[model samples]
Target: MSSTLTVTGGAPLKGSVAVRGAKNFVTKAMVASLLGETTSRLRNVPDISDVAVVRGLLELHGVRVSEGAEDGELVLDPADVEVAAVADIDAHAGSSRIPVLFCGPLVHRLGEAFIPDLGGCRIGDRPINYHLDVLRQFGAVVDKRPSGIALSAPRRLRGTRISLPYPSVGTTEQVLLTAVRAEGVTELRNAAVEPEVLDLIAVLQKMGSIISVDTDRVIRIEGVDSLTGYEHRALPDRIEAASWGAAALATGGDVYVEGARQPDMMTFLNTFRKIGGAFDVDDSGIRFMHPGGPLRSIALETDVHPGFMTDWQQPLVVALTQAQGLSILHETVYENRLGFTDALVRMGATIQVYRECLGSTPCRFGAQDFRHSAVVSGPTRLQGADITVPDLRGGFSQLIAALAADGTSRVHGIDLIDRGYEHFAEKLAALGAQAVRDEEPARV
Candidate 1:
C-alpha cells in the first residue's frame, strides 16, 4: 500500500507504543518448523507480509499453516511438505533470505531438495557461497540449477567443521538448521550470534536439538536421528524498536515503546546516549526522549552481534542529522546500505556520501563509493517532500524524516515496510503522528 505523511514540522511525538515478534526471527522460525517430525506451535507471530510470504511458501510444500484466534499465534504441520516444487520454490527464493535455509532440512528429510534464488535487502552482494560451503562439509552434494539450487545426499550426512568468512545471520541459521539433523557434531567458527539466531536455537533446542554457543564466536550442534515439534514464542523485533526510538529522538518527542525488550538494545542505547537521547526501561517497555541538550555527533561502526547492528544504521542516521557537528558512520556490514541517504538528501538533510573510508576501524565500505559510508552534517532544517522507500529500515527512516519535516510528504512502496513493521499505521496514529494509508495519484 502507498503512504502519504503530512507533518507540521518540529512536532515531538508523544505517546506509548508497543512492538511485536521480530520479523527476522519469526520468518526463520517458520522455516524451522519444516524440520519438525510433529506439529510445531509458534506464538507472537507478526502479521507482516514476509510472514505471509513464508506461510505461502510452506503451503506450497504441503505444510499446513493455521493462524490462531489470538494475534501472532500459528500452528504449523509439516507432514504434507512437497519435495518437488521447483518452479514455486524458485519464485519465492527471490523474496526473502530465509528460503535458502530449506536446503539442509529438505536434504535431511527427502534426501534431495531444490531451493530457488534468495532475495532481501540490496545493501550488498550477500552471496550464499558460505552456506553452500558449510552444506558441502556436511556431505551434501549441492549444485546450482537454472531454476534453483539442487541437492542430494544418498549417504547419511556427516557433520564437519566449518568457518564463515563473515558473520552472516542467514549463513549461520542455514548451517544451524541443516547440521542439526546430520550425523556427528558440527562446529561453526565466526558465526553470527544475533539474538534472532539464538532464539531459533532456543526453538530448535526445545525440539530436541543439541546446540551450544561458546564465548569465542564458536557454535557446536550435534546431529540427531529424529526431531520432534516445539512450542515457541518469537523474540521481539529489536530493529523495529530502535526505529521507533530513533523516530522519537529525531522528532524530539517522548515515546514508550511497549513490548520492546532491553536485552537486545545495549548497543543502541549507548549510541543514543552519545546523541543526547535519554531513555528509561521498565517492565512494560522503554521510553525515549531528548534531554533538551545539544545533540552531539559521534563515530559509529557497524559489526556483528554485541556491536551496533547494520540494520539500525539508516534510521539512526536520520536522527543523527539533527545532531550538532559532523558524525562519522562506517558501515562494516553491507556495501550499498548508505544509498538510502540520497532519499534523505531530497528532504533537505546535509549528508555527503564518500568513497574513501576515513575511520581507523576495519569497515567494509572502504572500496565502495558512498554506498558504504557517509558524513552527516546535522542540525539542519528538514522539510517534508514526496519520497520512495528503498528497503526495510530505510523506509522507516523516510517516515521519521517526513514526520520531522514541515508540510506533507508522500512515501510510496510502503508495502515493503510491512515486511518488517507490524501495524505501523495504527502505531503511528496512536503516537499522535498524522500518517495515512492512501493510494498514489493515478497516472495520467
Candidate 2:
C-alpha cells in the first residue's frame, strides 16, 4: 500500500463513516486474554496495525489466535503458553511498547518474561518507571539489561496498595492486569476512570475476577487462582468519531459517524457544540454538521476523563483555524502535543506555541520547559501545502487540515494513520473526499 496521498481541497466532506472498536481499549483487552486459561472471544475488533502488533506478540508467546464466525471477531487460546526466546522477543522491539504490558501476564503464565525496549509515538515523555514500580510492588524481580528488562516471579505475586502520581491509563492498565492474578487484594489510588478503563474492568469481571470501582479514582481487585476465557465486544472509537466530526466542521461539511455512542462522547459533543458545530444523536450514531456561520472560538483544556481528551485537541485545532476569533488550547496530558501546530502554521493558519500553562489551572508541565499550550487566531484562509504525518493523532489532524485547505496538498507518511484508523481511505471515499493514493493515477 502507498504511504502518500494526493489531496485536492475546497470541498466539504459529506456522507457517513463507521467506527469499529477503539484502538486504545482493544489492544489492552487482547493482552488481557493472555490471562485466560481457555479460549477467549473478542468482537468488534478493528483492523489497525496496533492490533496486528499485539497479535504477533501473542502468537510468539504460544497463544493460538484465530478468527471467529463473525467479522471483527477474534478467538485467542492461551493453552500452550510458553516462554518466548529472548532473541525472538527482542526482534519485536521498537514495533510497539505493548511488550512492557506483557510483563505481568507473562510472569504469571511462564514464571519469567523478557521485554525489549519499547517504542511509541513521540508525543512527550512516556516513561516505563510507573509500570516497573507497579510490578516490583507485586513482588516481581526486575533486572535491567542493555537490550531490555527481564522480570521473574520467585513465588506467587502478592498484591499491595499502590497510588499513581497521575491517573495514567497505561499504568492503571498494568496494575489491573497484574493485580487480578496476584495472591491478595489490591488497592489502587488515583486510577484512571475513563470509559475504556471501565470497559476493561467489565471484561475482567466476566473472566471471574473480583474488581470494584469507587466514586473517587479508586480501584480494588481481589486476586484469583485461575481465570477462564471471556466473550466481549469492545467499545467504539470515540477519538476517531471526534476526529471525523472535526473534519466536518473544518471543511463546512456534514458527516454522520456510525457506531458513535453519545455517552462516551458527551464531553467532546459539548465542546463541538460550543464551537458552533451542530450534531444530532440517535441510537446508532451521531451526525455532525457545520451550522453555516462563523465558528465561535473558545478556551479549551485537555485533561483526564470528564475533561476534554488530549487526543481530541489536535484535529479540533484544525477546525479552530476556521473560527472567527482567538482560541486558546492548553494541553495538560502530553507536553509536546502542541508541536503539530507548526505544520498548521506552515499551511497558513495563524498559531502561536507557548511554554506556560494557558488554562484555568496549573498542570505538571507548568514547572517544565515544554511548549504545552497554543493560541490559534483564525478565519484566515488555509492554503494547501506539503505535509508529513507526525504521530497518530497529529497525523490525522494534518489530514483534516489538508482536506480543508484550498488547492492541492501532497501528504507523506500516510501509513502512520493505519496504526489507529481502520480503512480510512475507504472512509474518506465514502465522505466524498477528493484523495487518491500516490501509487495510483491522480484523478482530475
Candidate 3:
C-alpha cells in the first residue's frame, strides 16, 4: 500500500543534512556486481527503495545480499550467483530502469537474459531504442517481448563504434556496461558525463576495466576476459542536495548539505546564486541560505551534463515561485516534466505552460503540445492543498512546495518520494519541519 505525508506549514528549517550515495549510480553499480566473481562491498550506499529493488534483483539471481548497522554501506555477495529465477527477474524488470542495466552483465555471465519492462519518472517518452541499438551493435540478439526484453549473445561479445543521437544517460551506461566485457575496442561519442555515469566508470575501473575518457565527449573501453569485485565509495547524490538547497531558499532558512560535492554542482550553484540564494562550499558540504531581500528569478534550460540537470529543474522551479521576478524554464530532457507544476499552480503559483519552443537551445524538445516550457511569475503566496505524487522527483518537489506554503498539506503517494530519497521523514524532522504519516487514506 502507498503512504501519505501530513506537513504542518510555517517552519524555518536549520540543520546539517548529509547527502546519500547517488540512486542512479549505485543501482547500476549493484548490477555490475553480477559481472565480478568476488564479493562487491559498496560503501556510502543510500537506504532508498530503488537500492532495495536492485538488491532484490541481485539476490533473486542467487547473489547473497547483506546490510550493515549503518544505512551508509552494503555488501553484495555475488560469488554464488545463479540465473535461475526468471519470474522474479521479470517482476522487478518492469519496476525500474536499472533492471535493464543488468542485461549486459547477465548476458556475459549466463549467455542469455530476460529483462522486464522499464518504468521510471514519466517526464517524457523515454525510449530504450539507443540502449537496444547499442547492445545490438555489440553482437547481441535482442527480442522485445510483451513482458520484457529477451536477449541472447550466441557468440562471445564484440564491441563496435557507436554514437548516441543525444547524450542519453541510460543509453550511455548501457554501452559502457555491454562494451567493457566484449571483444575489441569500443568508442563512444556524445556520451553522458554526469557524476553518476562517472562514478559507474570509477566502479568499473576498480573492477579491472580499461576505460579512457578523451576530449570532445569521447570514451574508449577495452574489453577484458574477467573482472573481480570492487570496493568503492559512491559520489554524493547531487539531485538530493539540490532539492534540499531549493527547500532552504524557498523557506527562508539555512541548510548545510553535507557530503555534497561542489565541483560537480557548479551549474546548479551558479544558477542558485543568480536566484538570490547564497551558499558556501568547503570540502565537507554546501550551505544554502536566503539573502535579506526578495529572491530573484533566473531563466533555466535543462540539458544533458554541464548544463542544469533535468531532475533539479522541478524543485528549483518551486523555489522560483517565491522569487520576485519572472522565471523562464525550458525543460530540454523530458516533454511532460511541467505537468506536475500544475499542482503548484493550484496552490496559488503563477505558472503557465507553453506549447511552442521558447528558444533554440540544444534540446530534443520541439514545437508541440508537450508543455516542455514553463514561465513562472513570482512572489507567489502558496496555500497548502492535498497533492498526489505522480513520480519520485515530482513528489519531492510537491513536498518542498508544501513545506513552503501556508497552513497544512496532505501529500498523497508519499511512498513514491521514498523510492529515491533517503531518510526524508527523519531529515524533515531534523530540519524543524513538522511532518507526520497519516494512517488513513488521503482524499484526492
Give the alpha-carbon lDDT of every model. 0.85, 0.93, 0.87
Better of 2 and 3 by TM-score: 2
- Count the clashes in each prediction: 4, 0, 0
Q: Using alpha carbons, what is the TM-score of model 1?
A: 0.96
How much is the lDDT of residue 434 in candidate 2? 92
Which candidate wins on lDDT? 2
Candidate with the larger TM-score of 1 and 2: 2
Please estimate how well model 2 matches the true structure, expressed as its whole-model Cα lDDT. Answer: 0.93
Inter-residue clash pairs, candidate 1: 17-258, 45-72, 61-82, 93-117
Clashing pairs in 3: none
* TM-score list, all predictions: 0.96, 0.98, 0.97
- State residue 27's C-alpha deviation in candidate 1, in Å: 0.9
